[model samples]
Structures are given as structure tokens and as C-alpha cells.
Target: MPIKYIPYTPNTIEGQAVLDNITRTKRVLRYRENNEVYNRLERGMPYYEVETVEQVGKPSDNLVIRGECLSACAYLKEQGIKVDLVYIDPPFASGADYAKKVYIRRNPKLAEKIKAAETEMDIEGIKAFEETMYGDIWQKEDFLNWMYENLQAIKSIMSENASIYMHLDWHIGHYVKILMDEVFGENNFVNEIIWAYRSGGASKKASIARKHDCIYFYCNNPDTFEINTIKERQYLDKKFIGTLVDENGRFYVDTILTDTLMGVIHRVLDDGSIKNYSCRPVLNVSKERLDYSTQKPEGLVDLLLEIASNKDMVVADFFGGSGVTAKVANELGRKFIHCDIGINSIQTVRDRLVAEKANFTVKEVKDGVNLFRNPQQTMDKLSTLITGLQTKVEGVSNFWLGAINDSKLGSVPVYVPELIDSQQKLLDIPTINRIINQEIQNLSITAKKVIVYYIDIDDEKELKKFIKENNATTTDIELRDLKNLLHETVVNDELEFSVSKEKEEYSISIDKFISDRLKQKINEFNDKGNLQAINKGKKFDPINISEEGLELIELISLDCKNSEGEWFSSTEIKIDKLGYVIYDGEKSKDFWNGKITSKEKPLRIKVRNISGDESIVSVE
Candidate 1:
């Protein structure tokens, strides 16, 4: 006999729109997977290797990557890395903005200047501030498309025996349930776990007070999936009036037994009565609190990790807000990879893990772009372009010589022109003369030769006259097209950082941060009509560097001597006023002292800037 299949359709127009939206998004995702632009981006993206502490005998290592969740997951897929468990706490699309409280140190000299400037002050002699962390504002269609694409990428990296947990709330939980069905298949749906809490704040209007979040659990394959049975003990103190003792000296409550299960109950409930339940009690503030707005409790993640994964298995969390999943997984002896776009989120995780003496590497994935392909304006951009070119050339062979900024081909010093005009102009006489003279003066001990790369020459007559007139007895200048020499490829720039220990206390600082992608983003904002300018420019300022680049910093946190996975903040610095203190590192000497331990052990530092960008470094 032949079977017939029927397609389900919604009855209402609004409902139909929802279905059409998801269907359209899935098609677009497939289209992008095959698109040329995306293909090039995937090929040219950079991977950074940060510092990490390694255990003496352990083979596996933990990871904390900084990038968009979708891009990060796609990179993982391309690298052939698979995980046994996945858990995500993505934005619920609740149409709200989240902010972080900031505190700045109070210098007496600075306070006097503030008072002189007629700024108001509180009696505490410090200032408090707030900075927006991330936003959850999205059009319904856009939100659905974003979630669909991310879920698709996530599915590509899951093993056949893996399970995934999607955490959501009242805002878009129902819609995501349907989306999950499409991605993981309808037959793989397992359970809808409700996490009820009592942090009461609800609308005073007509709706019922919401006190729970929904976690949808699904597996990659129903036949091969593995899950451990979780059982809780019910004490037989007083509730069971009619208690009975079994042959093994185990006590149990006597209840009406069914004929089909009479023997099963006595054997299973040998000691304490067992309860198979789903709802878990809410977490109290006293148990564990990181002050993160959307942070999840460790106990909640513990239960899920216990049931879904085992020791030495790979676990992952892409929307790693508070890093609770990584923390719990590490405690359970499971390997973890956590990715987050927010700087504060990354900083929180790094500081927490470092204090617990957990060993892990921090890496960054870059979006591909050839910054030197066009006219360069800023000195920073020009420097970055030179560095990129140097890396590309050195990988093939030792074709270039000298250090990055002062590189040369043999004895000939190379010079790249910086033009600001929209129309590519020819190399001017004065620019050529200046380059020749500078090279002659810098390398005065030896005869010098100059090679300049340009897209166009203003005038061949002017260049010839300058070269002939200014060319010294032992010097020669030549011009070449840059396009013929440079081709885009995947590059990884490893940042340098140093840690110093004094009297058992450690201090860390970054030597440099290099990102051509970040520079491109800044240039796009400076120029009008770029789409990202309309999107991300509204929130963050373009990249800027000064004396120490410290002005761009937002927060710094540390984890000193972590032995377990539990993250405890050893010290944190914020760009606000509340962090100010007296000589004892407190508002008053008599107040509670929360000083970091001065012990010689592994150390980690997380640095976040005002633009919501983060970088982490560690030393063992």
C-alpha cells in the first residue's frame, strides 16, 4: 500500500505570515551558503592564538573565542570540530536594552577639578555611571531570519549522538519551538523544560505574572542519542504514615500498588523514595550571583549538564552570556568552547575562570577584508596594510626584508603611498623626492634604493624628471603597481602580552591589538552611506589610539590562582567613580577588605573597551 503526506498550513493570515517568514529565511540561508561573497569571507577570515595554561597530563583544552555566534560556529564547522552537547541562551527579542553599572576611581586631584567645573557630587565622594551592554530590538522578520541561520549553522556541527538546549522566554519561545522542529526534525523533539524563578517584576496590567523561562531540548538522532536517568530522593521522615521495611532493610512508604508494577517499586525504591519530576526550584541570590543582568544560575546548568553529557565529552555554548555552561562543564571534567560578542560577557567569563585556576586559551576570529586594496587615509590603516602584506609575503618565502615598518626587498627600502583623493592620482615629484631624501638620511651609512607601489601615476614626465634629478650617484627609485604583488589570504596575528609578579601579586598588560577589520569598520563610519554605519555606528565610536590606548578601555578583570572551575572575581577596574578607594583599597580602612590574593599561581586578564570589544591573555 502507498502512503500520502499532507502539508500543514495555518488558518489565519498572521499565522500564515509567520510560516512564510521561516520558510523564506531557510531558503535565503541556503542561498548564502553558496554565495561568492560569503565564500571569500570564509576563506580570508583570520584565527588568533592567545595564551593558555596547560595541565601536566591532560590532553584536552578549553577555549573562549570572541566573534559573532554564527561566524564562530561556521568556522568551527569548517575546522571539523564536533561537539556532543550544545546549549545556548540567546536574546529573547524582548525589545529591551541592557546596561552595565560602571564605577570610576576617585582621585582627590580629579575630584577637585570636577568640583571646580561645577559638577554635582554625592556625599559618598565618588561617581556612579551606566553603559549599555547590548540591545534586543529587532523586527519580527529580521529576528526570525537571524535565528534560523544561526540554528542551521549550529546543526551542522552537532554529532549524531549530541543534544541541544535552546533557552528562551515568553517573548519568542513559541516561535523558536517551531523553528527548532524544522531544523532538528519533528521526531527528534524531546522535552519542554520549564525553569521557574521568583524574581518578581511584572506588568501591573491585565496579563498574568510571568515567572519562568522555557528550555527546549532536542537530539540530533533519536536512535543513537544517549541520556542518563536523573533521580531525586524523597525522604521518608513523616509524610509516609504507613512505612514498610523491605528484605534488604530499606524503608519505603506503602501505597496502593498496581499489579503490573508491584515488584518494580520495591526494587527501585530500595532506600529513599524516588521522584521523577521536571520543575526545579528557583535559585536564591545567596547561592550564586554574578550581577549580570541575564546571568543563569550554576545549579540550573548543572542539572542539564548532568543529564545530557558525560566526563571528557565536548560541550559548547555560543551565546555565552554569563559563561555558566562552561563553568559547570569544567567542574564536571568536560571540555568546553564558549563564544560571545559582548565585551562584558567575555570579561566576566575570563575573570571567573582565572580565579578558579582553570586553564583555557582565548582566541579571536576576524572577518576578511583587504585593507590595502584602495587608497589609504589614516596612518593606522597604512601600518595595518603593511603588516598584512608582510605576513602574506613571509608565508610564501623570505621575499621581503627588514622589520615590518621598515621592510625592504634586499637593500631596497619599500614605500607605500597614502592618498586621500577619490580619483587615483599619479606619484607627485615632491612625494618622490621626500621618500628618496628620507631613505638617504635614515640609511646614511649605506647607499640606498627606493621602490614605491601605486595604483596610478599622475605624470610619467614628472616622475622621470624627479628620479633623474634627485637620484644620487649610488641611489635608484622605481614604481610598481600594488595590485600585482598583493593577494588576499587567511592571516592570523598573534598579539603579544606580558605578566609580571611582584611579592606574589601579578599584573598583566597588552603590548598591541591589530585588526584590519576593525579599521575598515571605522573607515566605513567616517564615510557616509555604509550600511554598518547605520547599524553599528549609532552605538560605538570608531577605533582610536592615543598615549596608552587606555582611553578606549572600559573594564579590566582578573582571576588569580583558579584551581577549580568556579569563577570568583579577584579584582576589577571600571571607568567610573564607585571603584575609588582609600589606601587599603576600600572606601574606608574599617570597611570590609576585598583585596585579591597575593599568591604565585596561574593568572588571566580580560580587557574590554567602550566599543564592546574584548581581548584576553593568560600566563601559567
Candidate 2:
């Protein structure tokens, strides 16, 4: 029988452009009101924000932020700290069950029972209860939105030479891959490494058992990410072999030079020859060894770090389930950031890091940033940090900005702006366009002219009628034909109008309202083919801090099961600048105001202020 072959046809401009738009749009959506807190990780000396800075390292100076990864990413971005690498192992979403226990009432005995029930179910490995509980807490749309928003912030915090590895299972891996391609360009796509592990779950029905996970590796820029050489020991033998030969003219083990002090050699029974040789070069042998794991091994990670690792590389992992990447990065002396909404997974990662003795610091940034330090007390002001870093990584940062900004429109418009560095003259946008388009461009329709619709009404009925009469789809119109349909009207937020535009031909460039002078300046840079400003800063060595920074001393998580996590029963407490109130739930409803002593774990105990000085609060 002859083989019937089929060829893949990629999306084109003549196809459904709406789908194209959907594909191009970043998956992350942010609630602006909630994302503004991402601004103060290490920007300044926060203690100077007031006269006195309280030292609350009771749990330990080492801290770990315990919160949702989506919100965490935004907060980290606002801090303006550069991350070197990120690795996360998120839910595979392949119907695998994850469970956690929650106390429903104030009864400790009941809580224990519930906890025991939860534990029993987990031990039994039942999926019913877990699915039921988790399903009610999250929706598909919510997950996708949260994923997108965090990915946005993740992109912002990475250093130029950084790389990110996102791990996923079969269910959402494909969706995440497509989203990743859009966020991190197709050009930046590095690898889709399959992590094959031993003793995975079994598929007892009609299908084969599953045994592997997927890891998507992407870089901020080509040739900029880290790559390290894999290492192998030189030999397997523990004892050194001698270079001496037997008197019988055969190479054999001999100890003629065993006694250097006596300078004597004892004759062996087999060969009655006394050898006076005392000076012989020591002999050594070497052996080669290879790592034996199908999935990413420590050796692989080590190699990647060696090659792609850079100073302050922010590695982000949206999955962050096992925290393998983060763990490896930490061991190899690299910075890491991980994200996942799964509370159990977060706790597992924290525990694993603790067990591994990883040294790190964590802080919860409300909105998208934390007030790590005040601007006046900062090594440099917030603006200074932004502008200074911006000036240095402007080229890389601008490229990202342009890519993200242009994604909203069709393509990044061809424009000219002022040149900050002379080396930019060598850059070829056409080449960039060619490279990017080869991987993701649609080739169906071109924009002959831009028609600004000022109103939310469609007078395109005539155009539709014309298209209907012509027996053609609106997407089939040629560039010449497109000019004839050009019309303008003012539009509001809600309207029913459609543009039958195809993906290829020419991309449309839309600009929001900006001063003509600014546009003109940008145009000049575009026309002149200006390049991004070169980074000029002194390279500093990585700080060596003890493991004290990464410990999770004690956390005071709240519980308001019948109400909300935000609402607590407290009357005698006052809200502080940080918006937190201290209250004694067991005793009186009295409260005190002070910044959290540590974020590794929260405390519910009230802190008293004496002479408005935290020193008065005894360490005990």
C-alpha cells in the first residue's frame, strides 16, 4: 500500500486573524490597583525610612516569602532587583491530584480530625476529594490570567544574559509553550528538554504509563545565557600505582622505593634481585564517567549554569513544583526566583531548600514591590536605580520593551530614535525582522492605509456588502483594494466593529497619544538607526552571606475560615504604616503596630513599643 503523506500548513495572513491576535496577546492580565507594590527589593536602606529600624530576626535573618507566585512576581519586579536565573516545576494538570488540609472551625480536636482525614485521603492516594476542593478554589481562566501576569513581571526582572526554565506536564505544557514563545520570542527558544524519571505514575487503563515531564529553556538574548562544562573525575582507584618494573622484565607492582629513609630495597621471593631505585615518577590513571539520568541531571544544570550564568541573573520558574532548578542554581552559587500557586508545593520547596541548607532571603512585596529601603536612604534613589540600570541595559531592555509594546499592535513599527551608543549603528532591524518573522510571522494581509475609528460604530457595512458581492473573504483583499475601504470614526470602549485583516502582507503599527516632538525624536532614532545605550558600571563581586538569609524561622499565617483571611477579630489594635495590625486572639483584643519581624514566617503575638524603640522588645 502506498503511504498517504500530509504536510503541515502554518497559519497565514489569509486565515483567521482573530486567532492570530489571540495568539499574539500576552496571556498575563494584571489588576492595576493590586500590582503597584512591586518596587523595593534592594533599592535602598529601608531602615532610614524612619528614625529607627527594628531588628526582627527572631525566626532568623534568613527569610522566605510565602505567597502566591503570581502576586510575588509583580512584587519582585517593582523592587528592581536583577535576577540571574529562574526554574519552576508547576502542576502538570494531567488529572494528577494534589491535596491540603484546612481547619473549618476553632475546635482543635475537630481541626485535628479534619487534618487526619485529609492525611488519610492523601495516604490512600484518592483524587476525588482533592479535585473537588481545588476546583472550587481556582478556575481555568483565573489560572491562565495569573500565569500571564507573573510571566510579564518575570520577563521584566531578568538580566540581559539570563535564562529561564519552565517545567510542565502534558496537559498545559503545550499552552505554556505557545505562551512562552509569544512572551519570549521564538528566536529565543532554546530547548524543549524531556525529563524522563523512574517509577512515575502508572496508566492502568488502555494507555501506557506516563513517565516524563517537559522543560522549556529560553534565554533573554542569544549567546548571552550561561553554559558550563560538565565535569568527570580523572580516576576511580583510590591508591596510587607505582611506576616500578619487576626484575623478570615484566611490568608488575613493586615497592623497591618504599623506604626512603633506609634507602634500601628488599628482594622479592619470585625475583631475587635487589633494586636500588628510589626516584621514579608516580604513576596515575584516569577514567571517564557520565551522568545517568534521562531528565535534567545536576551535571546538566551545572553545565548550563557555567555557560549561561551571569551576575544577578534572574531565573524564573512558573512551575516551581520540585524547585530542582532553583536548588541547583543555589548550589552552583546563582540567584533564583520560583513561582507556583500551589501552597503545598511552595511548602515542599521551602522544606527542600532548608534541608539542602540553601542560603537566600525572601520578602513579600504587596502589589508588585516592597519598601526594602527608602529612596533618600537608598544607595541611589529609586529613579536613579531605574534610570542608571536602564541606561546600561537600555539596548536589551529597549528590545524587550519594543517587542512587548509592539505585540499589542501588529508588528514593531520601523522607527528612528536618538542613538545612545555608537555601536548601535551596526544593528540591522531588517535582519531582526527577518529572523523573527521566519519563526512567527503571518503572511496573508498588508495594511495599505491606517483608518482611525473615532466612534464605536460600524459604517463598514458597505465594505462588507462589496466583499460579499465580490465572492471573497475580507481577508482576501489586496493592499491596493484595502485603500478603498479606509474609513475613520471615533470609538468608545464598547463597540461592534470588525477589521477583516489577515496576518501577513504588512503589520499595522498603532501609537497612543504622545507629543509630536517626542515621536519626532523617536523617529529620528529609528531613521538614524540608533542603538541602545551601552552599560557602563563597575563590576562588583557577588556578596557572600551565610545561610542565615534563607531560613524560614517561624511563620504566623492567619485563619479566618468563616470569614476572610484579611478580616480578624481584633478591637484594641491599630493599623501601622505597613497596614498590619497586631492582636492577641487568645487573650484580649488588644493590638500593636510594627513592621513584621520576619517574612520567613509570620507571628501572631503582639509587639509592644517602649520609648518608641524596638530595642525595648526583648529578644526572647
Candidate 3:
């Protein structure tokens, strides 16, 4: 008997999680209005300047929003956008950091060398550096607080009849299951469809290798909601598994009855065993592989979409990793919205959908603060930019993000909200009180003062007056606006390219490229030989840049008709990991020549480097 109920309900604690937790009745947190989500929304939900208006085969209303999903959902809710079906593979809170293997583009000499030799087909040979997409590290309390708000944000834009499938592993699924129950109500719970993967490997030394992921399904309206019956897919010869159809003319498979997800979910059930599902992980050689670590298989999403939605319905995935949901939805004739905060994710999904001729508008979320890439990068950069902020706070709890060593005050505790989270940006009486009396009350009494960084304040005067009246803690407190400490830390890499005309063909040759940041990262990596365990004693190979930095270019696109505003790539070329040029819609086995010819008269051109930093030049 699997224990579906935990005696200790996850979020049931009355002020058990955090003072700023969200419940069904209380959706908003303490002055969370100060968070960037509300701050951006208050600006009249301004449409993030359009990055692209991609129209491939047919005109589609699909969207790829490049920003935090919570903020994007807020914008969608404000814009009157309603989604009928949603599937989000959000962070599992597994305390693991996922990184993408960054490959350096090959120089022309190496390209020629590889093309000349038949054996040089390995693309992983070009592992330049690893770029972390996002860190899933979180404090359990903060995680719950953030998730409660995230669910509320997502629920705001969902239609009355909308259904949501939340994909998570055993790590924190059980806890969030309780959350879903509270947010969507236990009555709307449809099914816990377990996505059991094909691969299964458990270890005796460690715990069983949990291979399956749990997908909790919920609907806004149970009375009207209906899940379409999906049968085993037809074979190449168009034969069903059972070769049988019911009176309603729907195919059915008699042998496969279990709707389960045992292959990957690692936790032991009450019976001390796990179940399995039929879904398989996307293999590297499969066409579904998008080179994104967090990318899900199309088969999995396809099954879910078919079950939960009708054709041409509005589908959405807030935590859209590599755009699998959007891609599968587009293929199935459904309008889609793919939202992710990573630039790489946005670009990858755009290319994937564009190849299929899917239409979508790419929009950027205007996070006025934090000029850095994403939350993880922003936090990491803050660790260095903040002068006296100490990183080592092992003894202190998560409430105190870090300790600032002040010469006058000694070790002053700092309470900086994780910028990646949309939950804890605002500062008000409740939040200030929590910081002073509740959470940080446990801070070391020896600390002379505490520093709190807030993105927004409900009312600074009111808050200060309240704090002055209610300062019960022994240590003094100081409030600092998180935005004030932020300075532009992003490096703008230079580019050199030329355009020439040859009759109908306008040849755009990228002569050189430079990314001082990538070069610096490589130097730091080589200097601080902190290689993974597998390469403990091996000699580390240093990435050498040629005088002409043409090797840095990974992708090139041309917008022939438009020079500004919205961009639609009429012609484009991409350098795959194998160092081969995928020109327009075709991939050539021959190596790249560092020059591409476009038929459309080039108005503005965009070039993306191997590190995923894009720079554009207008054709004069």
C-alpha cells in the first residue's frame, strides 16, 4: 500500500513554512507587490519589445516569452490571455545545478581538417566550457513560499476549464502535490499520471535509481472537464495494438491498461516498491534531441496534450525548457506559449519551431533591475559585486542569505531575497517584522546589525515608522534597496562582419568575432584546475583562439525586409555541434566556409556566438 498521505502535511503548518507563505485565501505575500512581477505589471503590462515575429509554414499565435514565467503569467493575465491546457516541468528542488556543455565553434583550418578526414565526426571534442542554465538550490521554506505564489500566478491566467499537468520527480513532488491540492482544490484532482521512462537502473550501494517522474493532473472545472481517451499509437502499417475499435469508433489497446510513471520516480511506495510507465527518454541520436539538458521527449508531451486538450486549443508551459510543449502543441494544431528565462532556451525553441514553419512572437520581460543574464547569474554576480558581503554562512539558516563583515559592526547578517524567485521582493510591515522578529530572530545575537535588501517597498515611511516602533530584536536593522546595489555587469562583445552584393545573391561573410568574456572564462577555468572527478589527473586542454575570431560564430540569421522593431529571419544558417553548417533548412556534411549567401536582401543581420551571446548589425 503506497502511502499517498503523509502525516506531516507539507504546507499545512500555520505559519509553519514562512510568515510570507501563500494559502488559498491569502494569495499575495508580504508586500510581494515590490517584487519585479508586480513592478513590471504596474507599468501597464508593457509588451516586451518584440524580439522576433517568426512565421514559418503557417501563421500561428504561438509565443516564446523570454523572462520569468511568473512575471510572464502576470503579463498574460493582465493582457486577457487565457490558456486551456498547461504543462510545466518546473524545477524539482533537488538541490542540483544543471549546466549545458558549451562547445567552441571550429576555425576554418579545423573545419577543413575535419571535412578532409572521414573519421573526425565527433562533435563533443569541442567542449569549450559549461554554462549553468539555472540553479535549483533553494531553502525548503523559501521554495514552498515561492511555489505557492508561482501557482497562484499561473492560475490567474488559466481558463475556468483549463487543465494543468505538473511534472516533478520524487524529490519534492509529494510536497507540491499538497500544494496543488490547496491551489486547484482536491476535488479537481484528475489523475497522477506517472511518466515511467524506458530506462531503469537501481543501485544496491545507494538508494534505488529513481527513473520515473510524477505528473499531477488537475482541472479548474471538474464538472465540464473531459480527458480524451488516447490509445496506443498506430504502427507504420497503420495497425492498432489491439486492432479493435469500440462502438464510438475509437481504437483501444486491451493489453496495456495501466496508466503509470514508475520508470523514473525513485521514491519507495508504501509497499516498498515503485511503478513504471511507457514513456522513454529522448536519445541523443533522436530527432527530438534539442541539446537542452532539461528538454523532455515529444512522445511524453504528445500523449499528455492529446489526453488533456482538443485540437486548436490554447496550450501553455510556463517553465518551457527547450519548447517541447510548444513544438508538440504547434504540430498538433494547437496555439502555444513557451516561457523560459534563459536566452539559450528562447533561441533553441525559436530555431526548432522556425524549422517546422511555426509562427510565434518572441517577447522579453523588462526586469528593470538585475541587468545580468538570469537569476542564477545575477545572484552569482551579486556575491562578488557586493563589497563586504560574506559568502560563508554555514552556521546561519537560509533566512540570512549571507553575512556582511563590517569593520564597525563585526559580522552583520544580510537578508537578500533570491532574485530568481518572484515571491519575496517586496518589503512592508509584515515582511519587515518577519525579518526582524520571526525568521532572522534566530540570527546570532553577537551580530551588531542586520541588512535587508528589498526590490520594492510598500511604503518606506510607514515601514520605517513601524520598524522603529516594533524593534524587539537585540541587534539593529538597516533596509537597503536591492536595485540600488546593482550595476551593469554584462560584457558587450564586439563583432566584425561585411556584406556584399553578387547579382541576386547578397553574400554576408562574418570575417571576425570577439568575446572578451568567454576568453576570460576560459583563462579562469584553466588557471583554477577544478575539473570534474572523471578527469582528475588528465591534462586539461586549453582553448586557443586564432588571431581572427571567426571560430566564435555559431549561428547567423538575416532579416531582409525589416531593419528594426520586429525581426523575421527570411534566411538563416546554424553551426551544429559537429562543426557542419545547416544552411537555411538543409544540413551539409561538408564543413562551413565562414561565409553564407542569402537571396533576400539583407536589412539587419544577427549573429549568435557559441556562448549564446547574440550581437546584431544593420545592413547599410
Candidate 4:
């Protein structure tokens, strides 16, 4: 299938941007294939070691990764893991934010507090209770660029007979089809399956209602692609009631039947004949619906899986929204890999697979580890730690103020060393010296002392000589060890909680919860100058040693099964203004009650904050 070309004038800004991004994508792909090298196994490095969550039979068969799809796919390619089938339900560039509706358990005290805060809670107030799951809002040019990069990364890990199904809607499907042709080649293009379904309210503004999503299927090699002929059973009881039986004792519909039975063949030995199945949208709610907005039915995924790949073949879904693809693949006994960027997505998929007793390993992959070391990762960690400390600190911002050269210490200019000269290769010295020169020149005009943070100072003599030679008599330079700062920050930043048991019920009291990531977000909101958001962020204290802190918790799920096994949702405690959990046949309960007898096996508990961050605690 040939891709339809859309004309664009290069003089226009949007057109120029799109063209530029396409050129850049080609260059990036080339550079990555030629220059980038990675270490497959690095201890203590993020994204290397796969954490064993629950082992069923073997650890490597089923996997769930929490990370960006592009990097995770790249890592998979590095590990020499090839997949037979890939189905991605990527963002549709719909220019809207998606949120999940979370219900909280309510008690009389919370109800009274709600009443005291407002006379009556309205629909908007209820909406305020919802948690933002993921955002699909993106500019057209940016969205296309993102999709192109991800597709390039994903294509590298596809096997020779692999087939990919890209699920999308009317929004950007056409544009993506053209991009896919560029990446996967036009000759490999297969089918454009239209999944039609009906749900929700219809828009009266448009004459025609948008009721279907488009799924573009492509293959690595069209001639050698793996495919199975799936058949749908045509009921013969209703149509062949008065039909004659053949010599083989089977009901026969004449081969010369009407054109309606075009592709169906007349068989002799069976009660019913089978015909090639047609694609249909999943209209009815499936039993696997977890209220995820972009969730697809397992039947739909099953059909795709059955047609494109066989049992025991490897399958992967990079945009694992609700993990329907993984769940369906698990049921069909296929090895699978599922990856997603959202924390809530990981939690939802983890809980779903655990409840189904599916064994899988979880891993977290983040950028910053390369063949050559980069200071950005360590600097980012330090920034978070510094911003999270609640006590008085010198010139600490709630957000990461970029690197030392570009960042500031309050109103004063600051220069942060890019690397420790002693620990790295000699090739990096010239670059370090250039950066030092730039920093010295920038700090020459300021009266404030320049503070440089470093992990080691093996080149201290040389650095001191350079500073002394460049000093203008008015400026002073101060050096601080990065390790000491990390230690100080770690000592102050800690989470406190206590647990008590009463027979089968367990109660957990959180003393405090502090996170630099949350603080950084609040600071970013404050930077945007949103007074309302800033106020809310300031009062955003979620965990404390009181019942009011419990109100901030969205869900607390317990796993009373084998602690070493997959975490099954044995009990859940949710808190909402008007919601309640039945306890001993009584509603409006505050504490969690687990039906567990022995805590000797170790208990696992997952606590989710309002912002969708999940913290798993193991109790022995």
C-alpha cells in the first residue's frame, strides 16, 4: 500500500518545523545505529537489573517495565531480545488530558469535615477528586517527532517475521501512516483495520459521529510474515434446518449459494461451516475493564494475537495502557513484555497481573547511563534531595535549577562542575577546561563567591593554579564535595511509619512522607505563576501521623497471600468524601481490615498517594 502524500509549503512555520523534525529523525536514527553503545549489565545503574516481583516458573518469560517506551525498546534491542508481535496503542494527539476516577473511603469525621468546608459538594468538586492519569496534549509537530523516534527504536527489536499493529484514531492516523511507510517501508504495509464501537454520548454539532478507531498493521517482511487463517463458525442450525444431508452424513448448504456467502466454502462432514472472520470493534464491556480510558478489550487483542503470532511466541506492547495485551497474551501462554511511562499504569498492571496470578518481573529504566558517564543524572538526584529538605538550607530552590553553570544560588550566579577530573577519561579534560574557562569568565563580573560541586578533586592543584591565574582580585571560588552534600541530604530525608496488628487486621500509621519529586513539581507550578496551584502545593501535605493525613491517601491494598508470590489484592482501603468501606457489616470505616492469619510469611502493602505515586512496603 502506498502512503498518501500531504502537500506543505516550506515557507510556512508549521510546514518548516515538520520537515526539520523529519530530517532530524533520520539523522538521529543514523547516529544511534552507528555511535551509541551500551553496557547490558551494570550494577546499581538504573534500567539494568530486572527486579523479581513474583516468580511463577521462570523469571524471564513475562516482564513489566516502568519507563519511557523509546529507551526501554532500545534496551530490549541491546539485550538481543526479538519479539514476533508488537501492538502499540500510542497517544492519539487528541489535545486533551485523561484522568482516572478514584473513590475514597469516607467516615463520619471526614463527612463532617467536608460539610464544614462547603455547604454542598457539586459535580466539579467530584471531578476535583479525580487523578490525572496521563496527558495526551501535544503540539502536532512535537507529537509527530515523538512518534517517529519511538517507532525507530521499536523497529530495531522486531524479528524477521514480526508484525506490528499500531492502534490509533482519526486524529493523527493519516500522518502516522505516512511515517510508518518511511520507517517500515511501503511494501510492508498490510491492513488498515477499522474498529467500530458505540458508547458514551454522541456529538450533535457534527452530522456524522466518530465511532471507530483505526488500527494500522505492518510487517517486517510481507512475503515471509507469520500469519494464521482464523475462522469464524457460521451457525448452520438457523439456516440449514431444512437442508439435505450429504453422503458423509453432514448438512450441506449448496456451493452455488448467494453472493452473501462469498468467501465461505460448503463443507460436507460438519454441522456448521467456518468462514474467514471479519474485524469488528469491541462494543460491549469486557470483564477486564479496570476503568482505564484507553483500555481495549481482550477479545480484540486475542484476535490480533491469534492471527499474527502463535502460542509461546514473544509479544510486546510499549504503550501498555491497562495491560490488556499482556493479560490476553498471558492467558494464551505467550511470553510478553509490557512497558509504560506512568506510575499509575505500572501499579494498575502490576495489581491486575498479580490478581490473575500471572508471574512477571518489574524493572525501572531511566536515561543518563551511557558508554561514557554523564553528570546530569547525579546532578538531578542532588537537585531533588536538596529541594526535598524541609529544614533551613542555604540557597536551595524547590526545583532543579539546571546545571551549575546555567543555574543560580538564589539571586547569585553559581557554577557547578560538570565532572570529577580524576575519575574520567583524559579525552574529557579539554571539554572540562573549556567549561571552567566559561564559568570563570561569567563569574568575573559578579561579587558573589562561585561554589563548585565535585565528586573528587584529583586535579585540585591544576584547578587552583587556573583559578589563581584567572582571578581578578575581587572574586573568590569555593569547592564543595558532592559526597558530603549527598550524605547530609540523605540523613534528613527519610520516611517514617509504624505498623500494629490486632488478630487478622493490620493498621499502619504513617509518621511522615517527604519527596523531592513532589516538591520539584510544586516549584514548577509556582514558576508558572499560578497562585491557586501554588497555594494548593503549599498545603499539599499528604502523609502525617494523624487521620487527616489518611484522607490524602487514595488506595491502600494488601497482599495476604504468599509474600514471595505475586501480590494479590486481598483487601483495599480507599478514602473519599462520601465513600465508605464495610467493616463488620458497618459502613464508613477508616482503618483497613485484612483477613490474614499469619504475618510470618511477610506481608506486602501498596500505598498510593493522591498524585498516583505507589510505594510498596514489605512487613515481616
The candidate that achieves the highest lDDT relative to the unseen native structure: 3
lDDT per residue as tens, model 1, 443-494: 5334345567764554777788867876654666667764443333223323
lDDT preference between candidates 2 and 4, better one: 4
Query: For each candidate, C-alpha RMSD in Å?
Result: 18.1, 26.8, 8.8, 12.3
- The candidate with the higher TM-score, 1 or 2, is 1
**CA lDDT scores, all candidates in order:** 0.55, 0.34, 0.72, 0.55
Task: Encode model 3's per-residue lDDT on 315-388: one tens digit a residue.
Answer: 99988888889988988899999998877888888888877767778877655454465677777777777787
TM-score for candidate 3, residues paired by index: 0.81
Clashing pairs in 4: 104-575, 104-576, 105-574, 105-575, 105-576, 106-579, 404-416
lDDT per residue as tens, model 4, 535-587: 67754323122333443355566676756545555555554334433321234
- Candidate 3's displacement at residue 44, Å, is 15
lDDT of 2 by residue, 504-616 (tens): 32111111111222233234444333232223333322212122211001122221121222212112232221112333212222121111232222212221111010111
TM-score per model over all chains:
0.52, 0.37, 0.81, 0.57
lDDT, model 1: 0.55
- By TM-score, the candidates rank as 3, 4, 1, 2
